[model samples]
Target chain A: MSCIPQTDLTKNRIEEISSSLAEPAWLSKERRLAWEKYIATDVPDPKADEWRTINLNSLDLSKLKTTKLNPNLGSFETALPDGGKLPKEMSAALKQYKEIAGFIWQTEKGTQHVYLDPDLQKKGVILLPLSLAVNSHAGLAEKYLTKTRKFSHDNKFSLLTEALFNSGIFVYIPKSVEIEKPFLLGFDFVGNTCEEAVFSRLLLIAERNSKANIVNVLLSSNAKNINASPSLSLVSQLNELYVEAGAKLSYAELQDFGQHVFYNSRLNNYVHKDAHVDNLSVAIGAAQSKVDVATYLQEQGANSEVLGVVFGTANECFSYNTIQEHNAPDTQSDINFRVALKDQSKSMYQGIIRVDKKAQKTEAFQSNKNLLLSNGAKADSIPKLEILADDVKCSHGATVGPVDPEQLFYLMSRGLSQKEAEEFVVLGFFNKVLAQFPVPHTLEWLQGIIGETLCTQFQSQAELKAEAAVLVK
Target chain B: MTKTILTIKDLHVSVEDKEILKGVNLTINAGEIHALMGRNGSGKSTLSYTLMGHPRYKVTKGQILFHGKDLLVMPADERARLGMYLAFQYPVAIPGVSVSNFLRAAVKAKRGQDVPIKEFRAELKDNMTKLGIANEFLSRYVNDGFSGGEKKRLEILQMALLKPEMAVLDETDSGLDIDALKTVAEGINSLASSDNAVLLITHYQRLLNYITPQFVHVMHNGEVIKSGDSKLAHELEAKGYDWITQELVAQA
Candidate 1:
C-alpha cells in the first residue's frame, strides 16, 4: 500500500477508505458523519491561550495523503514474516523487554503480527486488531467505538482521526482477570513519500474487578534513508480507556517518532466507581508535538494518577494540556508533569483541576515543573484550580526555572566538574517522577534514554569548543 | 617540624559587594586542630565559605595559599581535589541522588579514577558503622529530608570518605545534641592524622569540650584579635566574649 495525495479532504476519500475495508454500514455512516464534523469544525483559534503557542497554520491538510490498509493478519507466529521485518532501531529497542504477556506490531501498511499467551486466551482475554475485532466482537466494538466520538466533537485533529483512522488495536480483559505481565502495542510509521499521514486508534476496556497493564510505543523509520522530505510526514493518534467499577488499569505511552515528524495525540480515560487508573506519557522525539490527556472520575471512590516526562532538544517544540475532572463525590485525582529542555527547545504546559459542586470531600492536585538546561531554552507553565465544592481539597503549583545554581555548586563542591555536576542534577530532577513508574523495565529504559541524550549534548558542545580552538591557532 | 598547611594573609572578602571578611589573617599547621570562635556576624562562616571558593564570596583583596599554591584562583571542585574540604553549617539537599552514588562520584573525582564496586561498598559500610549510621542511609537521597543530626553525620561521613588534608568544619556542631556531637567528634578524631589538619569553626565552646583544640583564636568584627592556647577556650566559656571585645576597645 502507498500514500496517494488527494486534492482535498472530501466525503469521497472517507467512502473509499470504508469501502476498501468493507466496514459495516453503521461504521461507514459514522465515518461520513465524522467527515462532515471535521469539515464543519474550524481550526483552533491562534489567538486563544491554548493555541497561541502552537502554529497549526503551517500544517496543510491538502498536502497529507492517507495510506490504504492491507487485510488484517490474525494469529501470527512468534516471529514476524519475511515481508514484515521491523526497522533495525525498532528491533533493537524491542529486545530490551525480556518479559511481556503479548504484543501486536503494526506499520503504516497494516497489522503485521499479533501474539498472545495461550493461557490468557483461555482465560477470556481478547487481543486483536481493531478492524478484526469490529467483525468478531461487533457488539462490544460498536458500543465503545461510538462512545469516544461524543467526547472528541470540538477538536479538529480528533475529528480527523475519527473519520480517517486506517489502523488500530483493541484490548479487552474479562471480569476479575488479573494479569501480571503488560501487553506491548508497537506502532511504526515507515513512510517513503512526502506528506504521508497515518491516523491510529486504541480501545482498551478493563471489566469489573479486573487488573491489567498496557504499554504503547510509537516509533518511525529513520528519515535520512527515505527520499522524501522528512519534515512533511504527519501522525495523529487517539486512545480511549475504560476502567469499569472496582477495576484497576495501568497505561504508559512512550513516543520517540522520527526527528522531523509532526505528531498529535489525545487520550481520554473514563474511570468508574471504586476503580483506579495510573497513566504515564513520555515524549522525547519529534519536530513539533502536541498532546492532550484528560481523566474523568464519573463515580464515587474513584482515583486517578497522571504523570508526564518530556525532554526536548534542538529546535523541537512541545505543548501539553491536561484536565482532571471530578464528577462524583469522594473522588481523588493528581497530576504531575515534568519537562527539561536544552538548546533552543521550548515547552508549554497548561493544566486544570475542576471539581463539581457535588464532589464533596474530593482531593485534587496538579503540578508542573520545568528545568531549562541552556540559556536559550524556554518554558511556560499555567496551572488552574476550579473548585465548586466548599469541602474539597484542591491546589495547583507550577515552576519554570533553570538548574539551580546552588544545587550545582553543592554538587561541584563534592569534587565533580561543572558538566558532571549539571548532569547529576538534571538526572536527579527527573528521577523523582520516574521513581513512581509501575514497571521496572520501563523505568530503566527511560533512564537510559535520558542519560544518552545528556551525553550527546555534552559531546557536541565539547566538539564545538575544540573546533574553535583549532581555528584560533 | 610540622609543615604549614594553610595561610590567610590580610584576606578581604565580600558578599554582594558588602565586605564580610576584612583583612583577616590566620595560619594552620599539619596535625593540629584549631578552633575559630566568634559571635553570629563575626565572619567565621564567611571565612570558611571563601576558603572553599564559593562564588558568592568575592575575594576583593585577599591571598589564600594551600601548601604554597594560590587557592583563590581555583574553582570549588579544584579546591576539593587539592585536598581542601568544608563541612557546611547548612548542608544543601540534592534530591533524587542517593548518598552512595554521590559519594562514589565524589571519590572518583577526587582520586581521578573510579574505585571498584567492592572496595567502595566496603569503605562506605565501614565508615557508616563507625559513625553509627544505618545501612538504609546509603540508599536515601543526599541530605534530603534528613534531620539536623542526620545532615551533620552525613557531612562527617563525606569527610571520612573523601579524606581531605585540610578540612574545615563550619559550625558543624551548631544544631547537634550532646550524643550526636560525641559521635561526630569521635569520627573526626578517628580520621585525623599527622599528615592532615582541621579548622573547627564554632559559635560556642560546647563542641570544643568534645574535640579539644591545640590552639583557639577569637575572631571579632572580621579579624582574629587574639590567639592563645586551649586554656583560652575554657576562659571564654567562663567569662563570655565581652571581656575580649572590651579588652580590645580599651587598648584602642
Candidate 2:
C-alpha cells in the first residue's frame, strides 16, 4: 500500500523501534502496515468540523520524542534501583493515591512488576507482557491482537500508537474459566522526559463462556502542576477487547495522568452472542485528554452497560466520545456519563447510539449529565441517536447545567458547609454510575479522588469569593 | 425563664425582588408547640425558609435569634448544626443518595463527628419503625420517586433522627391522607419535649387536631393577625381564613 505521509514522523524511527524490540518478522510487518495507515491520515486538523471544537492546535506534536524502550524487562514486582527509592516526581500523587488492585506496574524505564494470582494461572488464565506473548503465544496474539477492528482512515493517533508502541499488555482467559479476582494493569510514566510521547496497547480476550474483570490505570509519576508546552508529555494508548460467545467481561480504566500530560486513548469492545460487557471509566487528572469508548453488540442476546464519570478542575480540558453500536437482533446497550467541571475547566461529550438495519428488538439508552461548579467552568453535551431499525427502542438525553441549587440547599440545611454540600451532591450525582463498578475497592478509590478534587476546588472558590468580598469593601 | 428556642422580630423578607414576609414577628419557647396557619401565598413557607437561612429569601429587615445568637448572620448549615431543622413542604429529591446515607451524613454534620455505623443503622431503623416506615424506604433514594405521604414520613423520620432543638414543619400535612397525617403528627408529638420546641406551619387546622399546639397563631398577609389558645384553631377551621382577612381589612 502506497500513501503520502502527512506527519513529520519518519519511517526510519519506526523501523529502528521495531528492530530494537527484536520483534518477529510478522509483527514487524504489522508495525509497518500501521505506520503506512498513520502516514495516510493527516495530522488532526483544527479546521475540520470534528476537530474544530477540540483544542489540539496548541499541542506541539513535533517536540514529543518517541519513548525509549528499557532493556531490563524485569519480572513482576521487581524493585527499583537506589534501594527502592520512590520517584521524587510522584511522591505527592502517591500520597493521595489509594491502592485499587494488585497492579502490574510498567514504567517508562521498562521496570515491569505485577502480582498475578497463581491460582488463576493454575485455572488456565494467561497474564503476560505483550512482547512476551507475541513470541510465546504467537498464534493467540496474532489472531486476537488488533484483529477485531481495522485502523480508521481518519484516526491517525490510533494508527500511530499501533505502529510505534514499545510496551504492550496482554490478558487472556481460557474457556469456562471464571476468575474471581480482578486483573490490574498500571502504566506509570517516570523520568524528566516531559518531551517523550508514550504509546501503549492492551489486548484483552475472554474465550467462550469465560469471565474476568480487568482494571487499567494510566498515570504519570510527576505531581507538579505544569503547563502545556511544545515538550508537553503525551500518553496515547489503545485497548482492544473481545468477549466470545456467552462470555462476560467487566473492564474499567482510570486515567489520572500528570498535570502537564496530554492523553488520548480509545477502547473498542467487541461482544458476541449471549455475551455481556460492563465498562466503567473514571477520568480525573490530565492537563488535556481525549478519550473514546465504543461497544459493538454483534450478536443476539448480547448486552453492554457503559458508565463513566469525569471530574475536572482548574484549567483542564477533557473531551469524551462514546458509541453503542447494536448490529444484531435483541441486543441491548445503555450508557450514562456524568461530568463535573470546576474553576476554568472545560468538558465536551459527544455520544451516539446507532442501531443497524437488521437490529430488531434492540434497546439502547444514552444520557449525559454535567455539573458546572464555577461561572468560568463550562461543559457541552451532545447526544445523537441513529436508528435504522424501525422496531428498536432508542432514547438519548443530554443536560448541561450547574449543580442544582435546591440540592445544595437541601444538603446545606442538613448541616453541611457550602463546600461539603456541593461535594455531597456531586458525589451523589455520580453514585448511580459508580454503583455499576464490580470491584468495591475500585469504587472507593474513585470516590477518594472525587472527594479530594471537590475539597480543592471548593477551597479555591472560597478564597476567590473572599478576595471579591474584599474588593467590594 | 423558659428558654426561647427561636425568636423572630420585625422580619421583612423578599424573593426575586418581590416582598414575601412583610414585618413578621413570632417566638417559640422550648417545650411548646406553636402553630402558624395562613392561606396560600401568605408567606408561611417564606418565614419557614427565611428562619432556616435560605439564600434566596432575603431578610431585608429583621432579627432572628436562636438561643440568643443572631441566626441571620449564620449560614443555613451552621444553623442546622446549632440544632435547627426545617421539614420542607416539597422536599427536594436527591436521586442517587439513599435515605440511610442521607441520614448518616446529616447526623454526622449535625453532631460534628462520625456516628458509628452500627449505632447509626440502629437509630435509623428505630426511627423508621416509629414512623411506621418500611425498611425498604431506607434503601431508596432521598425523596426520589417517593409518594407524597412517604416524603412527609421521611421528613418526620429525619426530624426524629436529628433531634433538633427547634423543629419547623412547613405544611407537613398538605399532601398526607388522614391516616398518614395522624401517623406523622404522632411522630412529631413524641419528639416534642422540655428541651426542644416544635413550630408547625400549616394552612389547615387538621394537623393540630392530632398533635395539639400550646399556642395557635393565625397569619394573615404575612403577619400574625390573631393569637389564642388551641380554641383559636377550631374557631378558624370553622369560620374559615376569610374571616381573618375580613377582620384584618376592617382593622386596617
Local accuracy of candidate 1 as per-residue lDDT tens digits, A1-473: 66565653567877887777778877877777788888899888876656666656546677787777896554566643332366543443455555666788888889878888788889999998888887888889888888876765466887788888888999999999998788878888777656777888899999999999888888776666755353356788889899999999999888888655778888889999999999999888777788889999989999999999998888777889898989999999988899999889888898978899999999998889999988998898988778899998888899999888888887788899888888888788887787776765677666776777777776787688889999999
Each prediction's RMSD over C-alphas, in Å, is 2.7, 4.1
DockQ of each: 0.73, 0.77
lDDT score, candidate 2: 0.81
TM-score of the second chain, each candidate in turn, equals 0.99, 0.97
Residue A378 Cα positional deviation in candidate 1, in Å, after optimal superposition: 1.9
DockQ of 2: 0.77
Residue B80 of model 2: what lDDT?
95
Candidate with best TM-score = 1
RMSD of 1: 2.7
- Window of ten residues with lowest summed lDDT in model 1 chain A: A80-89
- Candidate 2: misplaced stretches above 4 Å? A1-8, A47-50, A77-103, A146-153, A191-193, A225-230, A463-473
Q: What lDDT score is found at residue B122 in candidate 1?
A: 96
